[model samples]
Target: MTLNSGRGLLAALGLLAMAGSLPTFAIAQQAGQEGTPQAVPVVVAPVEMRPVAGALDVVGKISAIDRVDIQARVEGFLQDVSFEEGGTVAEGDVLFRIEPDEFEAAVTQAQGQLDAAVAQQSLAQVQLDRAQQLLDKKVDSQMTRDQAKAAYDSAVAEVKVSEGALRSAQINLGYTTITAPVAGVVGRAAITKGNVVGPASGPLTTIVSQDPIHALFQISETDFRNLRDRASADPDNVKVTVGFSDGTEYDQTGSIDFIDATVNQSTDTILGRAQFPNADGVLRDGQLVRVKLESGTPEERALVAQGAIIADQGGLYVFVVEDGKAARRTIKIGNTVDTDVVVRDGLAEGDMVIIDGLERVRPGAPVLAQPAPDAASSGQIPAAETEADAAPAAADDKG
Candidate 1:
């Protein structure tokens, strides 16, 4: 071969060799990228068996156990209001006073009439006795004796009439002072001092009992039947919990003490009432609230944190760590109690559900799972194991 041709041949061979190495390098780079999958860090909690309550949610209103409207029974000017406006008062406490001048004068006149009737009765008795003695002696005529007896009887009747009048007048005098009929907190005074108030007056004021308030609600016929069936098994199982408008729950639990016998004709609903102690005065009359009526019977069910749930067009779903990877699961959620949701289906005990770092997770992605602080403390998993399992995955991510 010629020198130039040999040199050209060697260069062509080298070029072919370089072209072969390029594809090998490209394949190696692709393989490396595929081998190291991204590990998503997530906080997880194990599905646990807890006692979940079967409950019905409804809206309700708070009401006072006892309410009364104060009114003046006697016609008089309001002399004074003895109770503080919007303050608590005990039963039989004087709430208002009326002018007693007229009532007192009536009582005095009645007493004077009674005294006169008594004197007349005494005189009649004396006359009757004298007539009887004279008739026994044959001095007085029979007709005169009969007249004296009649007069005595008339006097006795008059005395009885006077006594009745006195009693009525005394009652009227007592009515001048109006007192609280029930122990409760008094509302604004409708009739202030110096205003003429009488039985015809609409109302002087209003009072409502504060403690042991009532929660009134209505339920559909179906719900009523369900409640009846549940209550038949356990009469005292009807428990109620109330939530205020601000989303804070009332501390006290109540019992279902009243249920109407007839369903509402217009709405086909049944009225129900639950009584709760309101010593703290947190509940107010006629305030709208949310009510949760739960059966006391405990039920075993799998539960997960509320934050773990996600939704899509299909329905509610959650991400569970399976084989060290995130797997999407469609769950049938039942009732929610507090911060946990009852899982009716599609979840098993011991499954680790992702509660935190869900934004970074995708289906089938490798995960660096660690038990949430709350879940770890609940004995679901050991804290040391969670930390140990997370360390290698974190190092791999860094590397």
Candidate 2:
């Protein structure tokens, strides 16, 4: 019986030893499984520095410098029209003619009356002199002398009145022809031949000066203030460039010609005007255009891919790859150019920023850097690579 009990005890000891060995073997297998290196795929873009200019592009319209409404100054019936519709004319060019026969006849009648008055005055003067001589000889009475003097004065007054009438008739006759007041392009005439036009008839046509033009546009209050401040710093720096609706750029540069004193109450925008030389008449009045207000010089700033930025609770941030790990960094953004953004702060040139797989990246995540595909390549970013980057670095080691 003692021998059988000793053998049972030995068997129990062997079982306990096997159990200890099993635990060690399991631990060794787990460590071996964790020794493999796993790569988490990610997309990266090189940081580039570029020039950024602070400017605001605004929409505007073109307008002529001088606009006039043509009207007749004197009352007359239009006898002949000499100007073609939409034709260019010079100052003092005859545009219309009124009938001058009545005016000329009035001048003739006034001249006849003045000649008769002059003859009567001469006779009256002779009568007065004769009366004075007879009074000296006591042949004429004082009453006759007074009568002759009165007749002479009346005749002289009539001559003066006729002369005045002749001058007025001449002026009226000259008013028969209508001439252009200023040199410009003439629009369609509102009145035709036989139409009586005068000051009361309003404008007979419209004219606009096209040698020089103005571009009118509105900008936000903020932009206006920025422009003013920049101008104040450097008196001759701010320049305005204009572009047409068809995307063609204007060669002539313009200066700020006008600024409204008061801001527009309804739109909160300020009205601005720029003067441009249009000697060739290339710019027309009331043409809609785009204005680029360049307030200052270009500034060197950091640039990054526009898609690399991610917005969340941390605000504008980018995933920077450092030491082969996904690092989240906040950045200050400046002006945007095409598909890239200018960084004012929080980034340096040549920093690798993740352009793809942002959804799978987080702080301290392990990332396998990959070049962004060129435009010629297929545009698909693989889903498996995205999933791998989303997993933890420790998980990568375990795999």
Candidate 3:
């Protein structure tokens, strides 16, 4: 062969030798020729079994169980606002007062009518007794006695009617003073003093109960089913906890009280509600919070680094080194514990999950696996061999 062609062949052979002898080591970083596939170096961590508490997290909202809209029950000019705006008030406390002059006049008029009726009935009773005594003494006819009895009965009926009207007047007068039906924090008065308000004037203010609060959250349909099934077997109490955006957790835990009967077709989720004791008024209405729901006893589960997970159209997956090659393993993941995610399926203990150098990896590609620094200290299984001793030997042979 010509010298030029012979030299070109040796150069190609040396490149091939270097590629073939590339070692699996943490520090090795190399690529093959234009069309040849080469081993990709990556940091791996073994799948571990961890004690998981089976906690599910979701965004929730806080609200009050008893929210009352305060409105005037009687029609009158508002004479006074008795309570401060945005302050706490007790039950039976007077919140507002309407003009009582008209109501008081009505009550007086009713009382006078009742008194007049009672006086007429007293006169009718005297006349009926006189007619009856005269008839017995043969001084009056039976017709005269019958007429007196009818008049007396009519007066008695009138007195009863007047008594009912008086009671009605008293009730109307009582309505002029508005009182709180519940002990709670009151909102700003919608109608200030001197404004005319009545039953049709809408709410004058709103009050929401503060001691016990409620949290509402959504759960996926799939997760809802799993939880229901587990509940049937376990029958244990499910605990609820909440945290705020400011990195503070609620001092009290809540209990699940309700789950919606139907799922939201648009989101494929169902609503779940929990009630908590919020004595300090820490839980307010319409506050967004993080809710964690836990149940059953802790169980050992396969866990992998959360950073290793990847998502595609099919679902979540991770790269694992199997028999010196990178393979794709589809995984069904559950709740997160610390920095790892619980793997429901598709992985087992001792499986080396690729956590670093994933950008250079492909399905079925040969990979040089090395334990991540943290994983090594945590006692992960050591790699079969290292490329620390491979590259130099290949170079010497090429020389």
How much does each candidate deviate from the true structure in C-alpha RMSD? Answer: 7.8, 12.0, 9.1
Error of 2 at 332 (Å): 13
TM-score of 2: 0.55
For model 2, residues 119-211, the per-residue Cα lDDT tens digits are 999999999999999998999899999999999999999989989988888888888887887877889989899988788988888888887
Clashes per model (N, Cα, C within 3 A): 0, 0, 0
lDDT per residue for candidate 1 within 360-379, as digits (tens), equals 99987778888888877878
> What ranking of all candidate models by lDDT puts the best one first?
1, 3, 2
Worst 10 residues of 3 by lDDT: 25-34
Per-residue lDDT for 1-399 in model 3, tens only? 999999999999999888776664322433223234566788888899988766788899998888899988889999999999888889899999999999999999999999999999999999999999999999999999999999999999999999999999999999999999998889999999899999999999998888788999999999777776655533246778888876567889898988888999999999999999987889998899988887766899999998899998999999987666778999999876656789999999888899999999998777777778887887775545223422333344334
Alpha-carbon local distance difference test for all models: 0.87, 0.79, 0.85
The prediction achieving the highest lDDT against the true structure is 1
lDDT of the structure predicted as candidate 1 = 0.87
**N/CA/C clash count, model 3:** 0
TM-score, ranked from best to worst: 1, 3, 2
Judged by TM-score, which candidate is best? 1
Give the runs in model 1 whose Cα sits over 4 Å from its true position: 1-50, 300-336, 339-399
True lDDT of residue 53, candidate 2: 71
lDDT: worst 10-residue window of model 1:
382-391
Clashing pairs in 2: none
C-alpha lDDT of residue 391 in model 2:
56
